[model samples]
Target: MAQPAARTGPGPRRAQDIFAATFALLTELGYDGLTVEGVAARSGVNKTTIYRWWPSKDALLGAALIDSRLFELTVPDTGTLRDDLHALLDQMRKLLTGEEAGAVVAAVLSAATHRAELAEVTRSFFLDRLGRELPLFERARRRGEIRAGLDPKTVIDLLAGALWVRVLLRGEAAPAGFVRETVDLVLRGVAA
Candidate 1:
């Protein structure tokens, strides 16, 4: 494959093309099948440039996932832990059960099983995503909705696990009110 010369200077568009190509190929080819050369060719960015920006396949995919912001969650401050979690989980329900991004995530996660590269990137992606919700917990603590020491990570894991199981594993939509009930249960645990 003929490599396009690396773009010269100051090109966010270059990064955008690269990330878009990464996702496209990620969806088309499983992680084990995705290649920098493929992304470079698809994006019209040079493979060397992609490598310069990201040292390895995992790094490239991780950068693409984070930079794409495809899985971003909006954490709402509803002034109560239950409401906030309900809102958050509702968003998750949409993403996990929705068609587009959900398919991409499922592809990557399925590929992660056999590919260490995919696993590393997927792990970082999930952790960073979960970390982004920290302020929700922070605000709840300030409002006395939960204790300061309450572990948000566990709560996040549990809530996400519920949706992932229903949507990813069982291929079922989360029943109506499931999000709110899950939130209430988790909030109740931290309430005392």
Candidate 2:
């Protein structure tokens, strides 16, 4: 009999599908209701495969958040701090404005509130992902685009918070020029 092939993780498309299913289920069922079986059925991945890839629901959700569009944000280097911030915020705006995303975000937050493991995973996941943007801030500093004493985390919080309020809190997409104007206002305060 032939031996089984060495198994690696799901490919990008498979992973995306799994992650998307995870969020859709999360939106529908909330965190406690999400399970690897449901993920397998929804994503068309085997239940054993999902369990093999991620040991627990927390772990699976962690990976899903890492891979999903709503959480897996990338920082853009637009050669200028202004453009970079605008681009980043625009990406966030799109996510925040997504119909299912807001519900999923709220569900995640609600679930995180009740689950310590989930809260830690959520915290670390955001920190780890958001930390990637530090490089963009460092680049801005090198180029004398922002003040020497500027705090990247604070700036990010300010910008992201504005968008979150507009979308999640106010339940509205960002009005025209919101990203640009927000970036302009933030850069004015932090500009070199």
Candidate 3:
């Protein structure tokens, strides 16, 4: 939940510095106006070094996101689907509200529309993360906490889609209790 520290010079910690710089630039210039030259200037890393690591600006941003650990998730096993989902949602709330990470997510999502590479990067990142959580849904189905017919993908989309609506489109933090309410609704519909 802590913001990454920006690097003043390149070394073993160069990537973190670049990532910090990238997020800072994203907040300042947005996706469209951001440039590798700008990032290099800010991070004190050479542009060629960045290019060696990432092929494009979008790729660099995606690497920065991964390096930030903002997208990392661990599905909880709390003996019931409802409890599990609440934990997952709560973690997601942190990712959305935490410094640097939230702004990076917003910038990437905003850029995905007109930038194909960025769209792919964003989609791939989410899909990969969701895949990691699928076993939770499978476990719930086996335990009959959720209906057997429910698709895990649909459930993931619903949960994450609602988050995107609140965080990205609405430009508001989800109201207090929104996570619990949303989990309850999804559970009611999918519960056995």
Candidate 4:
């Protein structure tokens, strides 16, 4: 007797459905309450299907974050460091303040603290984002837009840290014109 053909994995449509389900669950259940079974049920997919693509909830959530454009941190190249900084910072500010994103962001941040593996994944995600932006700083330095001795890592830490504390810890909306002010302050410290 001939054996059945091997099973192929999810295609693009199925992946989108899975991601949509993941986001919906994140918004409804929050991170702690979310599970693979829940996503499978919501997506009308099987648990094995999700498992084939993502090994764990953390992995699933990370992929959903990327796929849904929730982690959309594209570094801008506007020909000037100030302009680029404003663009990037404003993107971050909008992400943090957007109503649709608040629950998901809060869930992810809370999960990072409660789950060690998730925390590591979150750390890696942030490091990768920072790495992607390093070239922006490098370009600015090469063009004499910023000081020669500037460090990308330090700059990112200062900027990201301030935002993290303002939104997460203090639970305060970043003040009006916060993104512009942040860019100007950081530029003043680093401009050539």
lDDT of 1 at 90: 93
Worst 10 residues of 3 by lDDT: 5-14
Considering TM-score, where higher is better, how would the candidates rank from best to worst?
2, 4, 1, 3
Q: Using lDDT as the measure, what is the rank order of every candidate, best first?
A: 2, 1, 3, 4
lDDT of 3 by residue, 86-174 (tens): 88988887788776678778788878899899888887787777777888888888887876678888887888778778977887887
Per-residue alpha-carbon lDDT of model 2 for 1-192, expressed as tens digits? 999999788888888898888888888887878988999999999999888888888888888777676665778988998888888888888776767777777787778988988898788777885688898899999998888889999999999899888888787769649999998998889988
lDDT of 1 by residue, 38-84 (tens): 99999998898788878887888788777675666787888877787
lDDT of each: 0.81, 0.84, 0.81, 0.80
Between candidates 1 and 3, name the one with more favorable TM-score.
1
Going through the candidates in the order shown, the clash numbers are: 0, 0, 0, 0
Task: Quote each prediction's TM-score.
Answer: 0.85, 0.87, 0.83, 0.86
Per TM-score, the best of the predicted structures is: 2
Model 1 quality (TM-score):
0.85
Instruction: Please give, for residues 10-31, the per-residue lDDT of candidate 4 as tens digits.
Output: 7778877887788778888888
Task: List clashing residue pairs in candidate 1.
Answer: none
Task: Supply candidate 1's per-residue lDDT for 99.
Answer: 75
Q: Residue 155's C-alpha lDDT in candidate 4?
A: 78
